[model samples]
Target: MSASPPSPGLAPRPAHDATWRRDAHTIGLVGLAHGTSHFFHLLLPPLFPWLIRDFGFSYAQLGLLVSVFFAVSGVGQALAGFVVDRIGARPVLFAALGCFALAALAGATAQGYGGLALASALAGLGNASFHPVDFTILNKRVSTPRLGHAFSVHGISGNLGWAAAPLFLTGLTHASGSWRIALAGAAAWAVLVIAVLTSQRAAIADRAPGEHGPAHHAAARGEHPLAFLKLPSVWLCFSFFFFSTCALAAIQSFAAPALHTLYALPLEVASLVVSGYMLTGAAGMVVGGFLVARVTRLERIISTALVASALVLLTVGQQWWPATAAGAGTAALVLTALAGLGTGLAGPSRDMLIKQAAPPGATGRVYGTVYSGLDLGFAVSAPLFGALLDHHQPAGVFGGAALALLLGVACAALVGVGVAARRRAA
Candidate 1:
């Protein structure tokens, strides 16, 4: 509900006092906890083939299994925000991680599709609880000056969770010849996270709660839940975020098989390629975080990255490289690496831009609203791409993804140029 003029340039500054440092550190612990949950959370998407083989599922069944989780998680984030405002981040996040671990263990031991579906839904519930809580803690606890970098670190940590999961789970799955092993590993990690958080509970309570914060009231208003639909910049950013996430969702969902089918690599080896996509994304988040400090024109940077990612995806999609025998793995790796860079640059900028669009003190609502765009993007695009994969050639799927990215680029560029002009005129 206030405005601050932008400084003409960026500079490195020390973070706020010891309290802020302590809060950020606690958040960092949460980030690692999120990463662990995400390892199990994300592991399912890439493991579709393995699951199918293990459980005898059809493509439609597999699609529903994954899509339902995201659909639920997307709605879950908004609910989580409201919960965070009311109860504080500590308890909600602790519960989310704890439940997530239990769900993973359940899914691992699931004997049939029915049991796995229940586990998947529970995992979705766990994920939905975490994001809003995590963002609220960062926005509320961390000081203003350090928010950007802290968010970047947080985003990178989450991406690392996404990146590390496939490799770690696949390995555990491989060694033990059971998906249950992977779930057990995730459960163990969750226990460790809970212990760490429990140790830091006292330090966490000392962080200042905003005396007059409106997050509680705004969420309670509940009317006009789709209020974000009215804003131009929101739609623009939504499109940008939507397309970017489409790329991300596809890679996360399909990259392993794409690699395996195209290159003839084993399931385990193909899983590593999927890891590259996630790892590269983690690297991208770290880079994007630093760039936020230096790059004043985020719209331009996001547009440029989306366009580049589109090109890279096109290249990867168009060529039929048999990497099993020769050098195709390198090509697949390179394309995903570039795509990851695009993700890193775009992810935080999109969040920052969306946060800017809302009124002050409403970051939680703004983020929750904008995040729906991500869900919508994934929800719509995954089915479209999956259908494309089923109906058309592999090349067609990449081409379609490129088209989405190009649309995203145009949307981001238009919004960026408009914002820049408005700021200059002001």
Candidate 2:
């Protein structure tokens, strides 16, 4: 029997869609785009074993690629914010994705280190603008009350991206017997995401005809372009990113390799530990989204969570575990994954605190400036930890990471106090 067409009154009406529906659509699209950018962050690192085998590269040489990538990105990201504010985010978004596709292709076809470096630079260029673009669109387009959940989704999607890269890259290589093919696959992913974003461009657009009020305010005030750089809380946020991501870069670059050395686990198995860490971290972001709604003091949440993660990393660094490698490996991986969960708990509060720090109408600039600290942290830490790995000190990666997290805790505390003072003064 042919199904009868629904009566007009019974049909689902798009006009009457709930507010949450529209917010969900915007949030979902932004999360997907954010996740894709993060997926490229690990594009080269996960292939280190393959690159080392093919090119006879040292840990320092390989680590330099990461340093180069972030160094380029840190400078460009600060500038990308101005472009985003001037030109609009949608076009820049398309361009960023295109660069990722090109980066992946460059990696796929590389014959040596220079080719790999070119790929890294291209990916850095792609990454340079995402935070500015993302936060601008979210703040402008999404409804206010849903913003906290949007940040949570953003953080969770990023962790998922970080988790997916190693498994995707290594699994493809092992299955297909070619690393080039794996990179080609990443290129295809970038292309697909670009197409998706282009189709939904209107929802994320910031430079639309009527959206010039914020830009006009800056011009009217005749404020210096670098004016936002003077805020104490802004630099404290930068310090927060710098120290925190030093710990993150350590894990991203060395965690799997360190696990392999210390535990006698195969590289493939050790890679799963990083994946586990990220997965559990994503889970933590879920609970944190709710936790931030109840907490008055964001710094306390940030402090407690990071301190816990630092302790776990410290424990692994101290090698306080069973005498047997098997027992120790199992225990260490569990502890590391737990640490990620604790860090994940800090994600929503971190964004909320940053939101509190931003002055009126300067979201893009403040986020761009502060987030450059993240790039700086990664650029400086990768080589330093690479030296530890070269010197046969697997545990220093975790210990150094713990120390960096402690620095981050101090910065977060300062930022929280500063924000509270500003509120009272206002």
Candidate 3:
């Protein structure tokens, strides 16, 4: 049966006839887009073993590859947002998907470090465009009340992708006995997502026009894109997110290994613990979405959360008794979970605040710029923590992360002040 198109002035219907079916399909589309992007992009940590064994790349070279992926993306997102504002989400998304597809194909065929680096950069470039476009679309199409849940759901989809990528690549390569073949399979998934996106493009386009008002407000608010650079609130948000994500990336990328080194836990057990942290994070995101609306003082909520996260994380590294290992593990899990939950809770408010702070019509640029701070956090954290782990105990890394979170708390408090000032001025 032919699916009916979405009603005019509404968000695009996923090429499905029934409303429920269409909503499911749209969600799936968003999920798949995020899934594939994260799946491909995050393949690095696991692929390290493969690359080291197969190509004899040093730790330094591998580090460079990972850094390039995120660094390019840091800049690329701004460009993507600009492109999104000018060309609209449909075209920009397709373009990003296309870049992803090509990058995947290239990654599968890479013969050397240089080849892999090129492929990674291309994939990062492609992955960069998804968020601004997806978030904008969801804010417009999904009901406002449900937006938090929608964001959380979308976030979980990405987290799921993150959790699964290493295992999937491991299983695929082991089964096929060929890393290239496994990577090729990954590339094929990207191709399929692109095709799905293409088939549904008209439907998505028809759903609703992009956010013209905020986009315009964004531009008007800042005569130049760099105008927000001087704003304390803008930089404050940047600093807050930067540190929050630094701790997050440390946990995401290195916590398990750090635990393994500290305790005698098997790699498998440590892996499970990390997975627990991430899985719980999905739940946190959903819950956080709900809490964001209920909470009266967002700044206080943010500040309190940051302080709590710092305290919990710092506890993981403290001196204790014989059961210290077990206790530390439990503490790490709890602290990381709290941190993740707080991050989820503040996610929407953070973005909305950034939009609010932005000069009118510059939402894309403002978000893009602030988002670079996020990238800055991750890109810097992974290596810095790695170095700390190499020299000091795993506890030192956690301690450092705690300090960073404290910094974030301070930044969030400053944003609160700015919010109050903006209200009075208005």
Candidate 4:
């Protein structure tokens, strides 16, 4: 016999529907904040050429400017996680946004390199809080089944922020004939975003998991602040991020010029090619979001993607194939996009791996410490590759990036093994 239809009263909303709605709202707000962080990340790099002309700075000096930004961000991020754990993510998030706005304003009105350096340092201070704040909220608030997609949305938003920066800043500068005006406009945009986020603060505010019970009690009893350093998995995760981000740093800081040198492409075309990589990487994140839910072996997913990405980078670095000029240009763009897609697919899996490795009650600290590796990688890449460019070794940038990815593959494998060993022991 057929089952009877449920009565209207009994047929009320499924629990998951409400849960999904909450997840959507939470992810949306967090993603917006994350995107703003990334948008500011590129605020200076795209204008490097202009800065060179205007400031009379050497390539290495300009690279040092970026290095200082991420170096400060790296140290502050690890510390900010502890703050998020202690004070909650909401206030820290607000403070970060305020810092970003101030940084932009400082940059806009700056008269010299000293002022710009100060602005970059302030921006780094702002940038430091985002990963800790974002992951703490997501882990605490989002339901389990939908977390993969939440991470995907988060990653995609960041990539979109990266993609948007050049278009917005460069277009404004071209139209206004003043980079400072473009920066001031960015500052204004940050304030508007801050206002919008403040209005929705209640929905996204969340204490780090386990904040009110054992962890807090333990802290009250004088638990060591560096207790998290005992976890082997944390260091492994940190290494993964450090090596993986080297590839990203190369793309963000050098891709346009690298393509131009390799393929004889114009600046506009090279910039477009870099933009394509970011957009396609965002699309790849969408695909990975779906894959993460279904794929049981997250490590294999991450490993395979990084390996493919490395091969693509190696191919481009070698400058092989595509004998004709037209073919070479086409090859460069295609390879870059493919490499982006591969890494994009890995993004959600990487986040999931970190989530799995995090200890109870310490998500904020773990994410903060591990993600600081990205800042360290970014800090190192600028001066390292800037020197290459200074010496007329454009190919070395991509080659070094490819090497980083290969090393990243090893790191991913080691992390997987480390997690597995810990689990088996447990």
| Residue clash pairs of candidate 1 | 1-360, 284-344
**Tens-digit lDDT string for candidate 1 (1-426):** 677765545322333356566766866775676676567557466567678787787655776676666677778876675566555766787788777777778877888887777777777777776655666667766666676777777777777888777766777887888877887787787788778888876544423556434454655676444455576776676567677677767777766666556656565666666667667777777778777777877877677777887888888876655445466866675676567778677777766665666554455555655565666666666766666556635565567767887888888777777677767887
Q: How well does each candidate superpose onto the true structure, as a TM-score?
A: 0.85, 0.95, 0.83, 0.94
Which residue pairs show collisions in model 4?
none
Q: lDDT by residue for model 2 over 322-374, one digit each (tens)? A: 53656788788778877899889999999889999988767888888888998
Q: Write candidate 3's Cα lDDT for 1-426 as tens digits.
A: 999986675655553346555555666677677777777666566566677898997644665676777788878886777766655667777777778767767777888988788877987788777776776566545555555566667777776777677677767887998777777777777788888888877545513554454545556655554565688887788788788878776776666666666654465556554455556656666666676677645677667666776776666656343434456555554455555655555555555555557665555556666676767787777777766666657776667777887888788788877877887899
Name the lDDT of candidate 3.
Answer: 0.68
Question: Relative to the unseen true structure, what is the Cα RMSD of model 3?
Answer: 6.0
| Model 1 CA deviation exceeding 4 Å by range | 1-20, 202-213, 216-230, 320-326, 414-426
- The clash count of every prediction, one per candidate, is 2, 0, 16, 0
Residue 260 accuracy (lDDT) in model 1: 58
For model 4, how big is the CA root-mean-square deviation? 2.7
Better of 1 and 4 by lDDT: 4
In order, the Cα lDDT scores of the candidates are: 0.69, 0.88, 0.68, 0.86
Model 4 regions more than 4 Å off: 1-14, 208-217, 220-223, 322-324
Better of 2 and 3 by TM-score: 2
Q: Which has the better lDDT: candidate 1, or candidate 2? A: 2
lDDT of 4 by residue, 139-235 (tens): 8889988899999999999999998988998889999999999999999989998999899987787954444733465578777767878988888
Clashing pairs in 2: none
